[model samples]
Target: MNTAPRRPVQLYRALLAAYPREFRGEYGAAMQQLFVDQYRRARTPGERTALWLRTLADTAMAAISEWLKAWRTAPPAARLVRAAGILFIIGGIFVPLAWWLGTLRPSFDYPYRYQPFVQDVLAPALFMAALTAFTGGAICLLLGMWPAANGHQRLALLSSALGSTASIVGWGALGLQLGDSWWSFAMGGLTLFFLGVLWAGLAADARNPLPHAPGAWVLAGLWIPVSALAGAVYEMVTGRWLDGPDWVFGLALMLTSLGMLWVGRGLAQMPVQAARAQDGGDA
Candidate 1:
């Protein structure tokens, strides 16, 4: 009947907020009564400590289960990233399909290298659409990870904003037929965009809640920079997107697409993982 012993019970009652209102409304009183009884029965300090620890563990498990069932209620950041993931996946699909379609065109076929983004009917349409989606998605990925960013949000945002703007403007320049070659204008934007992606990946990796999510982002970011650098090197050596066999470029694209797919999946599962992390005080 000592009042001091009831503090633990009170704390546990407050922690009940972890459960949904409907659950509490239905079983709240009974659960509290049971906890009170259990606390009172713990006459020794060690017993009370044990009970509190056990109760917290049980509550964390229950909270994770219940919260997962309400994943639709995840924070805005989670939803944004989820949507970005889907967009990335869509872009990934479009790029290869566009490449395949472009390969069928006799004029654009480049042996030993992946087909470059080209101006055509369906292929160009798909390629542009894919780039638009990818740029938007990459920006969202950066913004979505903003809240959880340990210290890299500002740099990530600046790079993405500048890069995305450059990319969009570069495309606009081509649309206006301002450039002699698409690559002449496109390379600048593409370079900035690639850098943005690199920083964004690092930012996401900093404090990302989902497993392997950062790795996926990094993989998605790596392809372009590597490809561009290699292409530059190849140009210096022999030019023309590389000499000899061209499987490496093709493989990089394939892996980048896979990386997008992985990032999409990870974002999809992020709501559950984030909720659990927050509940466990790890978020």
Candidate 2:
């Protein structure tokens, strides 16, 4: 029997390069040999094409599965941070929606107008949702920041502590029905400030490159200052508290939350990536 075509074998070898260098180095020759053997056995063009296609699909799937496994084996701290990132995102979404539906919607026509149903039922439920968001988000942030702290990340530690504290205070204020009071404003402002700090620190931390897409962490960090400025301007121009036009604030909140989620995901995958890189370097 004739040997397998050199071009097809070379092409298959190229495809296998999609895997990590470690994996390719360990099993590449064996895999190439097996593929060549199979190729030589196929008589028809259709059969050969089918075999190559199957090999490609199988290779892609195997690579993905291995990567996932590596990610799953990441450090516990990374996992915790990832969870926190998700909480930030969750709180970011529901908190705004709750505000729009429960408070803003009722008061749009008449500012501070109190509807009995909205105030008595829907408002309370939304408040609970907000409370959950704040509490959960705080816990996640604190947990996520713990590893960074141990790694001697002073800015990260400080920002995490402040952010977590603000979240807790925000939750308590909501529980006390002090939503419109000075306490709420102070805590909210503090929260925003610390979030900016956290993101700045994250951006500066060369040791830990955020796992999310580029600019996401920066944007999330910047949103706090920008939103605060906008709210301040609105307050100044209108001579009233920032309220309504819920869509704008809501959209901003969602984007920030999504950014947090992405960052957390990145943090979670960091350990695995680092380990793989170290292994590759060692090899």
Candidate 3:
């Protein structure tokens, strides 16, 4: 065999493929050069490994940034959008369907007399709403994943908006069963979560700065406990909280949860933006 040695330049060049194509196009050669320069300066394999790891971190950040930018900028094909729609539907259905199944089980009265709709229509309706929300959400998320799927991502966002709206409506209707009012702990939580998903989906395409709003933290902190507390309040005002006639208090508490979701959307966006910024800097 020839006595030639492998080149570090070649090694690092091969590693650049791990990055997204747009990123590679923008900075691949420069990164490879940096790797070569660092490798030339390092004396030990340990040092080389450390440098390579750092370079990899930088590359990953760049890839993620490129991915996000592409998600916002690209216009995806029709097929990709359709597939995303399917995934959203599947995920959405799982949520409400699971809840309905639990309700339908022989544990408690299925609210057949007081809330006839729960036993008959609402359960199926919720399940379908969940399916639609998820279908749309998934489409948005997947569309954001690839450059070719940009258009699909926008479509997915639209679907998510629709899904989120429908989810709010569904929660409102569910609240009515608990009371004539549209508020409950469960509904509140569901609404918040839906809003989070909707915002996450929207931000993917909007390129909005990650939500740094103070409201995000407040909502994140208060959403769950406040919901639970509403039950106590209901008990104090009325006799019981769990299965009561006046669900209006519960609805109020649940409505508060929407604030939490709105805030959470902001909180979630920050880290994503920071990560992208770091990646762009490295690239």
Candidate 4:
């Protein structure tokens, strides 16, 4: 047996890239050597497993701590953009989690089967947490995106901003015991948000020319409408006149999540005009 965990070592190397650049420059070689030594010394599979669990936890904490330190020291625009990006990624994580939580309601539909603590407290708490994080992310994104935008990007971002506001109002009204009518607002808001994102993706690509073929934005643009058309086609084939299969919505939701994630990543990595000005010695 080779005993050398090729995949784990590769993943660890990738995770190490998340650390601060200066920190890596100083400690990178030593850290990789230490991990290899520790892994090889573990005589049993269980020991290796325990080592990995500990390593993962420590890596996450240290990476976060290092990033926070960097954030504190970074320029104002960079700080804001990084914060927005992190918030967006967090929101993306929560979207599916929140959706999954909602699905649990039907599982415990009956009062006898349901626990009040879960329905009354846990679910609402989780949902509120998601809402807060996601809304904050959307607002921050608008702030970060506004600076470097051209006319088309500005227009798209304005649409996204409106979508964000509508979503907030919809979610807030629903929270306040408002009627089911608010759901329409919420749905409309999400549609606008997706549209704006797809539009922005195209505009941004035109400006920057993404390295990939056809581009990720194009995939998202194609998928959003295709998902709907696919759903309708399935509905027609299955003779479900009014609706399509559940997976239609699921597939769309998955694409939207991916699209949002990509958008956040791009925005986070984007050049801050202020930072660029400083580099160029322009006041």
188-283 per-residue lDDT for model 3 (tens digits): 444444444444444443433224454543433344345556765788898886553434533433444344344433322323323343234321
- lDDT of all predictions, in order shown? 0.67, 0.59, 0.49, 0.63
> What lDDT would candidate 4 get against the real structure?
0.63
Q: What digit string (tens of lDDT, one per residue) describes model 1 on residues 125-228?
A: 88677778778776776666665655665576557556655666677678677875766456666666656655666665535564455677677668877777
Task: Write out the backbone clash pairs for model 4.
Answer: none
Q: In angstroms, how far off is 246's CA in candidate 1?
A: 5.4
Off by over 4 Å in 4: 1-5, 17-30, 37-61, 105-112, 115-131, 175-177, 205-242, 265-283
The runs of at least 3 residues in candidate 2 whose Cα sits more than 4 Å from the true structure, single-residue gaps closed, are 1-73, 103-153, 178-190, 197-202, 212-214, 233-239, 273-283
Model 2, 1-283: lDDT tens digits are 3457889987988898666444676788888888988998889999998998899899999988765664476454545555555555565565555655554445464445557556666666664565455455445545555443434344544554565566556655765787656455555644554464455445544444345355666655566557777777898999986775867777766666666555544543344343333233321
The lowest-lDDT stretch of 10 consecutive residues in candidate 1 is 110-119
TM-score of 2: 0.53
Angstrom error at residue 277, model 2 = 11
Error of 2 at 203 (Å): 3.4
- Cα error, residue 163 of model 3, in Å, equals 21
For candidate 4, what is the TM-score?
A: 0.69
TM-score for each candidate, following the candidate numbering: 0.59, 0.53, 0.28, 0.69
Highest TM-score: give the candidate number: 4
Ranked by TM-score, top first: 4, 1, 2, 3
Best by lDDT: 1
